[model samples]
Target: MIEFRNVYAGYGGGDVLQGLDLKVEDGSITCIVGPNGAGKSTVLRVLSGLIHPRVGEVRLGGAAIHDKSPAAVLAAGIAQVPQHNALFGNLTVHDNMLLGGYILRRNRRAVRRRVDELAEIFPTVAERAHEKALNLSGGQRRIVEFARALMTGPSVLVLDEPTLGLDPKTCQAVFETTKKINSLGTTILMVEQNVRFGLKLASHGVVMERGRALLAEPADDLLRRPDMGAMFFGHGIEDPTAAPQIATASTDSSGA
Candidate 1:
């Protein structure tokens, strides 16, 4: 399990996560959704050790990791696929996958074995093994990115907007791949822009506003709420029939 207890963090300017608290259960797919600048990506950054929380603690399986370095976090079994393209354009897809296991380069045999295993799982990796990353289509590249992230055999996979900007068919492909990955026993923690699709794909859902988690519950229940649109748009819920499980927050919005 992953837990963030009163986490407060941000870039150099100001706090993006304001006294935030969240929890991700083990072996579950937890999807977080919110409007722009709700600090969605920032949560993934804190988890990946790209930024350390100024206050509070982040724990993975009960081990505190808020202060750990990026490498340490990766070694501790958490891997992230960022929102933007991260592949080296000039490098071959195979080379990129090799780089994902750079820390284990000393054991060339094991790393190579892992790559071969992933290539079997992601056929695009095998079909375009020698092709430069720049040569693959957007969808193919994203698949390679997913395969590369698995090189470390992480217990948890963090994805930020995995299907952003893709065609509808590609979006479905990506979501299918996400499900396949989850079936392989890795816990998934993701931030997605497509609310309905994301909620449908997840076992649990979290709603965020102004850097705070406003609601956390089973994804189906959240999806069924009639005031979902109101929540995302910052309009107070007028539905007296709405679930009482939702926690209300101040109307003011800030941070990214």
Candidate 2:
């Protein structure tokens, strides 16, 4: 399980995450939804050790890891795929995957074995093993990214907007791949802009506004709640067409 207790963090200007208190149950797919600037990506950054909390606790499976280094966080069985594609476009797919396990280079045999296993799970990895990452389509690239993140066989996977620029069909495929990964026993925590699809895919849904989690519940329940829609889409407010405005926070128009 991953838990955050009264956590606070931010870049130089100000705190983006403000007193966040949340828990992700073990072996579950938890999806976080919020408008841009709500600190959704920041939450993942904190988890991956890209950003450290200024205050409070972050625990993974009961171990304290708030301010640990990125390597330390990965060693604790957490892997993250950032919002942008981290692939080496000029490198072959196989090489890109190998880079993900660079720390395990000393055990070359183990890395190869793991790569083979992942290839079995993600056929695209095998199909494009010899091809440069730049040659693959958007959906295929996302699949390769997913495969790379799993090279370490992490217990927790943090994905930030995995399907950000894909078509509808490809987006669904990516979601299916996410479910496949979760089914294989890795816990997943994701931040997504596609609200309806994300909520439907997740076991648990979290709604954040201005750096705080305002609502957390079963995905189905949250989807059924009228107020949840109102909160996220700026519905029933002064201007319905305006971008979402968190009622508790000052109004702003930003894309999720």
Candidate 3:
């Protein structure tokens, strides 16, 4: 399980996460939903070690990870796919995937084996192995990103708006792939803008406001609550449309 206890994190300006506490069960898909600037992405940043919390404890199966560096975090079994494009446009899809296992470069055979395994899992990787990443469509790129992140064989996958900007069909495809990943035994922690769809896809759901989680419960229970829509958007959930306002923090920066 993953746990965040009283996490207080932010950029140089001010705190974005105010004593935030959240828990994700092992092998479960947890979707986080909230209004813009609610620190949803910031939560991911802290988890990925892009920024360390000023006060808190982040643990993975009871091991402390709050103060680890990004590399250490990755080594500790957490891999993240950012909201923005992270592909090397000029590189072949195969080459981009190889980079995902850069830390294991010394073990050439292992990295190649992992790549081959991922290609079999994500069809886009198999079909466009030699093609440049820049040439693939948005949905295809997202699939490749998922495959790449899995190259490290992480136990936990953190996704930030995996379907951001894609059409409805593409979003469905991404969600399906997410389900497939979770079924394969990787615990998933995701932040999605489509509230209804996200809730439906996840086993657990969290509602955040003012940088703190206001509600955390089973997804179905949250969906069944009559006041969910009003509390989250001041309206019904019929037309859920709100994007996160903050920039995602990159591995090299704290300016999320």
- Please give each candidate's TM-score: 0.93, 0.90, 0.89
- In candidate 2, which residue pairs get closer than 3 Å at backbone N, Cα or C atoms, i.e. clash? none
Candidate 1 accuracy as lDDT: 0.86
Over 1-256, each residue of candidate 2 has an lDDT whose tens digit, in order, gives: 8888888899995899888877888899999997778889999989999899998879998999998999989988999887766799999999998888876453777888888999999999999999999999999999999999999889999998988888999998988999999999999999998888899999988888888877677788768766665666633323343333233212111111
1 against 3, candidate with superior lDDT? 1
Winner by lDDT between candidate 3 and candidate 2 = 3
lDDT values, one for every candidate:
0.86, 0.84, 0.84
lDDT of 3 by residue, 129-160 (tens): 99999999999999999989998899999999
Count of backbone clashes for each model? 0, 0, 0
Order the candidate numbers by lDDT, best to worst: 1, 3, 2
Clashing residue pairs in candidate 3 (N, C-alpha, C atoms within 3 angstroms): none
lDDT of 1 by residue, 4-61 (tens): 8888899896998888888888899999998888889999999999999999889999
How does model 1 score by TM-score? 0.93
